[model samples]
Target chain A: MSIKSIAFIGLGAMGAPMAENLVKRQFRVTGFDMRQEARQALVNAGGHAADSAKAAATGADALVLMVVNAAQARSVLFEAGALEALAPSASVFLMATCPPGEAEAIAAAVEKTGRHLVDAPVSGGIAGARGATLTIMVGATQESFALARPVLDAMGDKVFHVGFKPGQGATVKTVNQLLCGVHIAAAAEALSLAEKAGIDGALLFEIMGGSAASSWMLKDRGPRMLLDDAPIASAVDIFVKDLGIVLDAGRSAKTALPLAAAAHQMFLASSGLGHGARDDSQVVRAYRALNAKPANDP
Target chain B: MSIKSIAFIGLGAMGAPMAENLVKRQFRVTGFDMRQEARQALVNAGGHAADSAKAAATGADALVLMVVNAAQARSVLFEAGALEALAPSASVFLMATCPPGEAEAIAAAVEKTGRHLVDAPVSGGIAGARGATLTIMVGATQESFALARPVLDAMGDKVFHVGFKPGQGATVKTVNQLLCGVHIAAAAEALSLAEKAGIDGALLFEIMGGSAASSWMLKDRGPRMLLDDAPIASAVDIFVKDLGIVLDAGRSAKTALPLAAAAHQMFLASSGLGHGARDDSQVVRAYRALNAKPANDP
Candidate 1:
């Protein structure tokens, strides 16, 4: 309850708004990002800006990593000396999506340095981030969760404590991405087939959006899939990475995830098709390519 | 809308209630089914009982074939003389989930007999049927749709005129089944991986049901998945049959539906494992079997 000072690393699309939310909640947020513009944006929004992750973490009550993945999270905490720089027993909230095994390993190393680690991965994308309505899944001991709760709540409305084990949150996130990735691809697959049959893609989605077939991804991503181009919310490479983490989690658990594995292929194909940086909804392009007619069948 | 009387065939789970909804709305509904009890149940609900499908359609204003599939629909209209039994130019509402090609064939045969054909397929299952909340998708000429609208609306709150051609509605329904099937199987694949990692299935779904990973199927079917003996809302065999129609539509369109095809195998496996008639959520058993650890691994 006494936590006040916080370190926020990686001020990209998701992290910047999250740090701004913390600053609005009266936390002494010191945000760090390699981009000078990103760092300056935080200071302009009434928070401190650090030149490096270690400098950001100096004696902070908590460290929030919104880095791209576990490797960057690791470089911030260990390679960049952020974990050692935090105050004793300061909670290190790893909010990056990560593989379960990597999360567990990072937790072990952080705990070895006398700091608590809270594996908290989030979804709801950039819009969720800016609105402070992201769903955060936490896997940490009760004490660690308690220490991280107020800071966590400032950035997200729905914060679920999934388990007491370090890697559990990441596993839940891995599963989440598995469902999300598959549902998007499935929507694309469904819509593609409907289009092939001469059904209007937009109307088909409107009907399916209200039916039992509806998914959050379908409603949110379905329209974008119909577009020739859409503003990027999250890129195809993001799922390429997340679903890669998902399959890695499956491998670590010795579990078979046939749908996730198949969905991962579509994202991979999309990235290979050179839309890796396009909106993830562009995964439909892969479907269109796969099911495109013989070009002269008529 | 002078379609004052209707012949409702196949008074099974979904059909029986749809017929009753029509009767409630003051349509004189004559019903037929193989089961005497099915026919008697319709009479108890203030509808008439017919000895056969042809008898039900005798001079009726509309003939609604809510039969098992296109084959049964063909049998009722063609083999049982129900098409000829109807008054000339009466609308024939084929409100069954069928392959698009098959729906088109039936439409051609009906149009040749001077009866208007509405390729109207529905989603929302038995509960939707009972509540008159089924989502009905129609692909018919505007004239045919206008004639069929009143009775379709009596049975469904959301009656969509999807197209001006027969079979487009069935194609939409096929796509709906594709999403629903993959989502159900994907939910199983996701939760199975979570369970393998020692995460609570109930808790995982609770987290996911509120996140972007959510689907109508995940929310509706997820809780039942955690139970050892949940009541059947819809059975595994139903999805097996429906997804089969989806793949058939895809094949006929020369579309490659990898996800739908993969989801079908799981349902087939569940049926092959003797859980076909069980709640569709029991498809998780297939995931469990596929990922079960060796006895000596732990």
Candidate 2:
């Protein structure tokens, strides 16, 4: 019941910063990753690096999975035998963005191993994760959320218990991605149109963002779009996966996700044009190529 | 150069309230409309009512056109004889939502008569119009914008001089509408997906709006989407026209507008379903019909 030791899996761009925050907050943290450099990075940051996922889970009060998808989260636990290696009373918090149904299924699998599962999905990007201000959406039993509150509080500024069902967090995250995908595409189109019309894209952004046209996507992605190439913060295929989950969830609900579907195609086109591994803002590259006008040129 | 007399044409929901605001501000306002009741409503509000657009334009230093589209705006000015009646140095502010190219054409026609044209588009819905806090996007030469600044100040709190050309206002407005169209559809899809998953739609709105999924559309349209019969504010076909302009601009620029195109279909379907006159948020109804769970139903 006491939160002392924790295992953080998947030390990538987001995960590494999140794990560092936990260690900074005085938690006994052990990190594990397949990448030797990632493990070394954690070891250099005053935290122990586990030899394996199961080794990290051993004697830990909580195991946090910050992997890419459900497949990796599953492999880290079930396939790697971390479920059997962790303390019987420990909790596993899956913070990866995955399909809602998969989260539910995984929760069932984790519960059968005599441990608690908190389907927690974090938002606000790596910046918020490192700042410990990320918004965490939780879908778990009230008891599980209560037990995980202290640890989650150390990582996120705001935590909402959206529902008692295990998959609801992922469900909300999917919906979030749908909006993000559509808004990003919408912003890119607007900027391109303005630029084509010989209007200043940056000035147009300032005017539109102050108007009813303003969106989180426009505000977040608009400036990044002004740069043709930045480091890949979040990839185009990330939306390809997230919006794919959105469309799939919509299909299951028999709901029509027209904008999300359309945005999905744009990301697909970006991926098709060999920018899949680049930042999601690179979706603008697809439009830029099609329009044949460099945004910075005119 | 005295600014005592003003004429307002095309007294629709927005125009009527706008003219009334001018009257309330103690301006010598004359309102004209094809709809008798629209004019009568202005008269009822203590403003002078003119029988024809030309009569209203005669002797006025400023004329504001709040008509539907470019063709209608042209017809009122030329065919309806308003242009022939205006004073030589008068300023005509076209406050309607029209395309940039059309605005440019209209500006050319207005300037041919030695009159100035201010391409000013207002935002903030009927409530904002009534409250006199609408945001006005104005595009004009320095003299024209200066001539209309006080008038725009009387109508809106935020007056942005987007550019020096008449079409630039329309261009900026089109950009705003593109994001507006995409965000509304995105909000609908996100909310519907959450509702379909047995998650509380209201709670989902609260969570997503507070999270990275947040946007002006989600805040503006999310609650109205929950109403059984959404009150008509802005109709669905409005987005149809707006997105049409957006996509048309994009296509003319050879820019891809996938999100706008997708959002366009939802509005088109809403229009086709006989909900064109309903609130734009009623696009959620399209998702409802597909899901067989009405948005208003808890």
Number of the top candidate by TM-score?
1
| Model 1 alpha-carbon miss at residue B105, Å | 1.8
TM-score, every prediction: 0.95, 0.89
Model 2 / residue A19 / CA error / Å: 3.6
lDDT of 1 by residue, B163-255 (tens): 888998998988888999999999999988888777788899989999989999999889998999979988999999999998888888889
User: For candidate 1, lDDT tens digit of each residue in A102-215?
Assistant: 999999999988889999999887899999999999999998988888988998999989889999999999899999999999999998898787778889999999999999
Q: Assess each model's interface with DockQ, reporting 2 decimals per model.
A: 0.82, 0.62
Residue ranges of candidate 2 with Cα displaced over 4 Å: A1-4, A20-27, A34-49, A230-232, A248-255, A293-298, B1-4, B11-13, B20-28, B34-49, B248-255, B292-298
Evaluate model 2: give its lDDT: 0.86
Supply fnat for every model shown: 0.88, 0.79
Q: What is the lDDT of residue B26 in candidate 1?
A: 99
Model 1: lDDT equals 0.91
Model 1 chain B worst lDDT window (10 residues): B289-298
Cα error, residue A21 of model 2, in Å, equals 4.7
Q: What stretches of model 1 exceed 4 Å from their correct place?
A: A293-298, B293-298
- Among these predictions, the greatest lDDT belongs to 1
